[model samples]
Target: MNLTDATLILLLAERIHGTDEGVREAAKSVVKKIPRGKRDLIYNVINSPSPLELVRHVAQNLDT
Candidate 1:
C-alpha cells in the first residue's frame, strides 16, 4: 500500500514508542530524516486538537 509522507511519519511515530527495539530505532532514524518543514507539520498534527481533515483521515487509518 502507498502512504503519503505525513501518514508514514505518523505511523513511524507510533512505532517509535512500540516494544520492538529494532523497529523503534528504525522509526527514529526515518523521523530524524524528515525535513524541517515537514517536522512542523508533524508537530502540528500530533499536538493539534483539530488538525486538517486530510491529516485526520490519514491518522485514523494508521496501524497502531
Candidate 2:
C-alpha cells in the first residue's frame, strides 16, 4: 500500500488498541515518509473507519 493507505491502517490499529508509544512512533514514521500535505488525508481515512471494522480487517488480514 501507499504511504497514505499504510498510515491509515496503522492509525486505525492504534485507535482500536488504544494509544501506545510504539504505535504512535510507527504512525509518525509513516507520516514522515509522506509529503506534509498528505498527512491530513491519512488522518481523515484513519478516522473515517469504524473501530470494529478496523480490528476485524486486521484480524482477517493476519489470518491469511
Candidate 3:
C-alpha cells in the first residue's frame, strides 16, 4: 500500500472519530482535495466498519 494514501486514510479516520462538529467542517475541507466524483467514496470508507478497510480501499483505488 502507498504510505501516502494510507496516511490520508488514517488522518481522515482520526478527524472523523473526533468531535462531530469539527469533523463536519474538516470533512468539507478535506473532501475538497479529492475529485468530486470520488468524494462519496472517501466518505463511505471513512464510515466503513473498520479502519483497516479504509487503508485497503484506498490502496486498491490508488492502484487503479
The prediction achieving the highest lDDT against the true structure is 2
Compose the digit string of candidate 1's lDDT tens values, residues 1-64: 1125645655555445443343333334544566655555455454454334435465686576
Over 4 Å off in model 3, which ranges? Answer: 1-17, 41-64
Clashing pairs in 2: none
What TM-score number comes out for model 1? 0.32
TM-score of each: 0.32, 0.37, 0.37
lDDT of 2 by residue, 1-64 (tens): 4754764667565666664444444555565667766677445434544534443455467647
lDDT score for candidate 1 against the true structure:
0.48
* Candidate 2 Cα misplacement greater than 4 A, ranges: 1-3, 8-19, 41-64
Tell how far residue 28 is off in model 3, in angstroms.
0.9
- TM-score of model number 3: 0.37
- Candidate 3, 1-64: lDDT as tens digits: 3334434645565555644434344444566576656567546545655545454455567657
Clashes, model 2:
0
